[model samples]
Target: MNTNSNLNYTQTGDYLLPNLTLNQPRKPLGKYGRLRRTYLKEQRPVLYHTMLLNGSLYPHLMEVEQTAENRMQQTMAQLLKQNPVPDKEQNQMAWVQHMNSLKAQAEELVLNELIYS
Candidate 1:
């Protein structure tokens, strides 16, 4: 007599951290699972920020909240003004690209400060 044993496992958040959190689930986990998918957990920050903005921060920024793009552009302009290219013959494209990267960094800094503050 010969017997065969097989264990087929379905990953139901077994690989997830104990403190993992998810804001939205892409699909229902079905009746067979309790653990939420990681893809669903990836967007928690956006959802959490949305909730914060909608709940307590809404009325506070009703008048003068600046868009992220605008902030970035402003930062870029400042950087350009401070570090303008030497002349029209200089590497204009490279200068512009560096300034744009600086702008993105500034924008990230702005976002982080706002979120953590």
Candidate 2:
């Protein structure tokens, strides 16, 4: 009986898989990103290029959205505290409508601020 009868050999490269990380921040530009960035820099040197290079544009928008959400939650909590809804089943529709209105107003305020700023 051969001692190496159960021994097997395979190519390691055949089973290789790419290591991917979920939390990795992607490059802002993908295909043709460099060209687009260059074009923006050349055409709109002061406003677009400066904001893009400083990384201020997206962060500012994110901050605005967060502010709007926070304000909406605070306003909704205050309104609910002031006007307690005793009957959940009876006022369910009205409560939803009121909350939606408040949310729309908050969003509008954020948009106006962004537009005028």
In order, candidate lDDTs are 0.45, 0.52
> Lowest summed lDDT over 10 consecutive residues: which window, candidate 2?
16-25
Which tens-of-lDDT digit does each residue in 3-90 have in candidate 1? 2433233445654222323333344333112211122234455654664444532322321133434555677677777876544457
Q: Which candidate number would show the highest lDDT if scored against the true structure? A: 2
The local lDDT score (0 to 100) that residue 38 gets in candidate 2 is 51
Clashes of each: 0, 0
- In model 1, where is the ten-residue run with the lowest total lDDT? 31-40
Clashing pairs in 1: none
Give the alpha carbon lDDT tens digit for every residue of 1-117 in model 2: 223445344445765333322322243433223433454467656865466555664454444545655765776676667766446578888877776776666556644553334
* Winning model by TM-score: 2
Residue 38 CA error for candidate 2 (Å)? Answer: 20
Off by over 4 Å in 2: 1-46, 82-86, 114-116
